[model samples]
Target chain A: QQPVQSPQAVILREGEDAVINCSSSKALYSVHWYRQKHGEAPVFLMILLKGGEQKGHDKISASFNEKKQQSSLYLTASQLSYSGTYFCGTYQGAQKLVFGQGTRLTINP
Target chain B: IAGITQAPTSQILAAGRRMTLRCTQDMRHNAMYWYRQDLGLGLRLIHYSNTAGTTGKGEVPDGYSVSRANTDDFPLTLASAVPSQTSVYFCASSDSWGRSLHFGNGTRLTVT
Candidate 1:
């Protein structure tokens, strides 16, 4: 099943922080995050594995909670470069990755 | 590395016509997938190949088909296009058991 993402849209100012949450009803073996700009392709950001783990890159980070079947993405000191649609892809035991609806984030200067 | 390339970036087709979207990956990845992106609907998987000569259906596979003749190429085909099939299609290749998915610039198709 496809994961669900919260806060369909969000607007933030520079130096602010925001969190995007994704949840699944079934157990998730892994979570992958990507960001897409308007009229462009989605770019991979990070991946979080199961068993309660976390991964970070630059000013972004994410945590995976296996028991809750949820994952959250954290963006610190938001920049205009961060403006884009964020999607969380869930991975079950299967080899395929299913994507969520996505949260559109706009960071203001 | 020219990680992935998709041909005919955008196309317009008439109903009941056939069209093919070409995708190629240089990473030598064994798994390739096809997905369609629509507003408010996110990305829907249409088909995937675990390796050469093997294919499987995904969430939304009614109007699409794919084949993995080799490790580097996976093409998506629409036999008899319909208006409802108009959307941006993405081609992706992955390794590491779905750990990360590398996507190509999508092809926007308009079926009239």
Candidate 2:
């Protein structure tokens, strides 16, 4: 099943912080975060495996809670380049990865 | 490396026509996937292959078929295209089923 993402859309000023959350009804083995610009393919951001692991890349970070069946993406001091549609993909004992509805994030100067 | 490459960046086809979207990966990943992206829907998995010569249906596999003859290629075919099949198709590859994926530029297909 597809995961659920909170805050369908968010607008933030440069240097501001934002959080995007993804929750699944089933147990997830891993959570993958991606960012897609307009008219472009999704770009891998980071992947958080089970065991309550947290990963980060530059100013972007994510946390996966196995028990909660949830993952959250954190953008610290957001930049204009961070504007894009963010999607969270979940893997749950299947060969396929299910993606969420996505959260449109706009970072303005 | 090219990572992943999708052919025919964009194409328009008539209803009931047969079309195939070609995908190739140079990363030699063990797993590959095909997904369709619509306006509101983020990305829906259509088909996937865990390794060469093996394939599986995903959440939205209807009206689509895929074959993995080798490790470097996976092609998605629409036997009879329909209007609903119009969307941006993306091919991705991963080291394993649960690993981060590397996506292709995508093929924009339109069916009228």
Candidate 3:
């Protein structure tokens, strides 16, 4: 089944912070985060594996709570380039990686 | 500059026509996936292939089929297209089981 994402949309100014959450009903083997700018393909951000440590890239970071089957993406000091639709894909067993409904984030100066 | 490439950037097809979307990656990833994105539905997995000569059904694979002929190409086929199949289709490749997925620009397919 597809995972659920919170805060369907969010708008913020530069230097602000935002959090997007993703939760699944079933056990997750790993969680993958991606960002897609308008009219472009989704770009890989980071991946959090079960029993693995939380990881981050530059100003964007993520945490995975294996017990709750939830993951959260954090964007601190958001920049204009951070404006895009964020998607979280859950990797359960059965060779499937299902994506969430997506969270649209906009940042302005 | 090596990455995934999708053909027929955008296409408009009539219902009942057979259509196939092309995808190729030069990274030689072991896995490839097909996903359809609607306005509100995000991206839904339509089909996937773990390796060449192997295929698997995804969540929404009823109207779609896939073939992994080689390590670099994985194409999605719709035997009988329908209006419901209209969406932006993306082709992604992953080196690991479900790790980093590099996506193509996507093909906007409209069936009417």
Where model 3 places Cα greater than 4 Å from the true spot, the runs are none
User: What does candidate 3's lDDT look like per residue over B7-94, in tens digits?
Assistant: 9899999999999999999998999999999998999999998889999888899999999989999999999999999999999999
Q: Whole-model lDDT for model 1 versus the true structure?
A: 0.91
Model 1 alpha-carbon drift over 4 Å, by segment: none
Task: Please write out the lDDT profile of model 2 over residues A50-91, one tens digit for every residue.
Answer: 799999899999999989999999999999999999999987
DockQ for all models? 0.75, 0.85, 0.80
Candidates in order have lDDT scores of 0.91, 0.93, 0.92
Give residue A62's error in model 2 in angstroms: 1.1
Tens-place lDDT digits, model 1, residues B52-78: 999888889998889899999999999
Cα deviation of A12, candidate 2, in Å:
0.8
Instruction: State residue B55's C-alpha deviation in candidate 2, in Å.
Output: 0.4
Quality of candidate 3 docking, DockQ: 0.80
lDDT score at residue A78, model 3, on the 0-100 scale:
100
TM-score of chain B of each: 0.97, 0.97, 0.96
Q: Which residue pairs collide, candidate 2?
A: none
Window of ten residues with lowest summed lDDT in model 1 chain A: A89-98
Winning model by DockQ: 2
